[model samples]
Target: MLLPLPAQAAALDGSQLSLLWGVPFAGILLSIAIWPLIAPMVWHHHFGKIAAAWALAFVLPFTVVYGLSATAHGLVHALVAEYIPFILLLTALFTVSGGIYIRGNLHGSPLLNTGILAAGAMLASFMGTTGASMLLIRPLIRANDNRKHNVHVIVFFIFIVSNIGGSLTPLGDPPLFLGFLKGVTFFWTAGHIIWDTLFLVGTLLVIFYLLDRFLYAKEGVQRQDDPTPDTVKFGFNGGRNFVLLAAIIALVLMSGLWRSGISFDIYGTELTLQALVRDIGLIAVIIASLVITPYSVHEDNQFGWEPMKEVAKLFAGIFLTIIPVIAMLQAGTNGPFGAVVRAVTNADGSPNPAMYFWATGLLSSFLDNAPTYLVFFNTAGGDAVHLMGPMASTLAAISAGAVFMGANTYIGNAPNLMVKAIAEDRGVKMPSFFGYMAWSAGILLPLFVVVTLLFFR
Candidate 1:
């Protein structure tokens, strides 16, 4: 559910919004970043409360300052409109994909892991990052469970499948889908960003293979306590779920294509008929997947709702606290964040596409990429025709930046964290937030620098 801003209401006047309004948003993000490292036990226990406190820190004072109606408008807009739709979509994907158990006793050799990652990267463009990651991660994890040095495989999986792999189409990732809704053609992203995707994704895959080959040699082959050691035949356990995955894709596509114009007004938020239909369809998909999937399939997959629950709780607060920050960004040059806008622009006022790439990427690395892309998209004049025409480079930069750089951190995109949580739950000791950043800084940043020169420049 997206809150439709009336033509009259440009959301909030950026000039009137102060830097003060943005502190809680910063607080929540910082807590998400630093707290998990210094206080893992407390963070795991009371993260939801931390998220809620930050949300209330903004909402309570905002109500006092702007009046109850304005506060209600803001909260309802973030909660009922954006957050619910986000969580439900993730839940539906996680639930359905978890039922799909890719059963096989394939060795977790360098070649096998690379092949699985490559397959997942291709599947991501059709089934979405969340769907593709969930479907393949379990098998990948199981394959590597017997190995000593396997965390690198998960890291590269995040780099490729969870992030870069989703660049080809709107269904692959949220930022691209937001662009689609803003009137960019369905194939526009793939047409413009395919080269970037190919280069970055291909480079990452090659790097992973060489690195894994080195690590495999260093660790040596040890099958002493092998879980599924013998080379059993490969087969999928829940084939029917493929149909459900296709239906999810079709339903998402329908939401974008259908334009009935019917809408409901909740507080100040407006929910469109198509969006309402999409959410309802997603709920139906979740229910159907649960009912149709056998209990054993889930048990074998080791499926649980903890990952989904964590994402929902954390992002619920993130969406709310982000409201003011986005509003401030919308304020542009007159607002507190004016310098950021200035940095991305030339002295003559045309957008620097390269700067747009880094700026969008950096923000998307921490903040939600979908909204970050929307902000920069609108900032670059918000006209699909112009963007696809003379401003084509600008739009492409924003699009690529949002999608590609999300792999920079676990919290960068929704599915990145989901993959991390799921991997940790399955007993893989994933890196801490900063530790993960070390991996990206070493492996991904150098690749991005090359990308900046080849594409954005």
Candidate 2:
């Protein structure tokens, strides 16, 4: 039996809320960005608690001011409607990908590294970014273990495989999946942003090739003692997980395609039949991955729950704290974020494609891109048909920006940090938060400008 909500429950009005309500959101993001750099041990041990405290910082005061009913409604909506499904899909992908171990290593020549990156880019659009990253990152690291200048390789991996490579389809990234759920056709992104994706990814690949070649030669003919010696043969362990990965793709597609007019309302959040089935199926996939995969494969992969646990904890806080921030964005021209709305609109009141690209991309760099996509999407009138047709350029700009520029920061996408953590765990010294930005700012930002000019303009 379904339980009842409070009699006076209703949605929070963004127009009525002030910008002070956004503090916890900003605080948590800053903490994620800064805390680790300033105090690594404390942040590492207590990051989850820090995230929860920020979540409560918003919830407690909001409940006091708005009443318990409204607070409960907001929490339910964020958790049930958004966070649960988001994390479940990520978990399934992480688990299945973690199960499969690439058994042999290759020499990390610039050409071979580039080839692996290109292959990962193609696989990303099919398997999801997290899946592709988890499956390929270790092998790439193992291949490059003997090189003196290998940090660039991992950074480029995050750029190509973790972020930009995911631009081709909804399965590639969370923001795109959210677009698919919002009535976008299955192939809409592939059709709309194919050329744009090709330009950005191709250019980055060329740049990576040249830079890697330079560094490879600079390190001289002699190499360090190879930590992970290359095997004569290359193959995969836990091959069954590949089928589970395919099942995950099928389940995501089915949820988008199937229409059952059946849904249940729980605490003002609508729970649809297809969505429930998809989430349940994902749970099964996770269990099956853990059960069917051999322990040796996981041992070889060094697969553990730390990365997944970290993502889950950090994002739980992100989703909860972002409630009011998203509410304000939803309020549009009348809310605290009114200036953001006006920036993306032309003087003639038509949507400006370039502004949509930058606005969505910039905000997405700081905020979670999924909800950022939704915000700009609604600001563009929330008509899927219209956006897909007459305002196709506008939609393309938003889609490309959200998917591509997530490389701007580690927190821009979930997999960015996961890949970083994995790299660090493998003893690859990653750049600091701002240090990483120096890399993105120098490399990615210039390319984004070119993208803006070539495609967005």
- Taken over the whole model, the C-alpha lDDT of each candidate is 0.83, 0.86
List the lowest-lDDT window of 10 residues for candidate 1. 1-10
Superpose all Cα atoms of candidate 1 onto the true structure and report the RMSD in Å to 1 decimal: 3.4
lDDT of 1 by residue, 159-264 (tens): 9999999998877887887676567877788899899999988898899999999999998877665676566578987778888888888777787678887887
**lDDT of model number 2:** 0.86
Record all residue pairs in model 2 with backbone atoms less than 3 Å apart, i.e. clashing: none
State TM-scores per candidate: 0.88, 0.91
Decoy 1 TM-score against native: 0.88
Off by over 4 Å in 2: 1-8, 217-227, 366-368, 378-390, 425-429
